[model samples]
Target: MAATDDFSKDNILGEGWTGTVYKGVLPDGSILAVKQLWRSSQSGKGLQAKMETLGRVKYW
Candidate 1:
């Protein structure tokens, strides 16, 4: 859990049809917006595929 603590109600920044966004701070003090996707919204394989696609995009 990268958040100031575990993803608690106090850390929730917003919610949407896709998932919930939480405010997080890394160990080095870098701020981050963390999104927790709903399990029912996408299958594990589908998520893996999307992550792979994003990895490829990063190389461009």
Candidate 2:
């Protein structure tokens, strides 16, 4: 779907402390939003900690 190129200043929908969202349009004119999470390379949160946090996420 070429999502990388689809996200641009013109497609920005919104943003927050965790990440930014971009609106994407399809060939058929359908619209969708992409949320790219914000993570720091130097957050000091180790792999174990990250895994633990993810494990706690309740996805229904």
RMSD to true structure for each model, in Å: 4.3, 5.9
Cα TM-score of candidate 1: 0.60
Q: Spell out the clash pairs found in candidate 1.
A: none
Query: What is the TM-score of each predicted model, taking all chains together?
Result: 0.60, 0.53
Candidate 1 ranges beyond 4 A from true positions = 40-60
- lDDT string for model 2 (1-60, tens) is 355355677777898666777877776766666667788453656645755774676634
Candidate 1: tens digits of C-alpha lDDT, residues 1-60: 846478888999898766787989888877776778775667789778866864565311
> After aligning candidate 2 to the native by TM-score, how far in Å is the CA of 53 from where it should be?
18
The global Cα lDDT (0 to 1) of model 1 is: 0.74
In model 2, the Cα lDDT at residue 17 comes to: 67
Clash pairs, model 2 backbone = none
lDDT of 1 at 53: 69
Residue 48 Cα positional deviation in candidate 1, in Å, after optimal superposition: 9.4
lDDT of candidate 2 vs native? 0.65
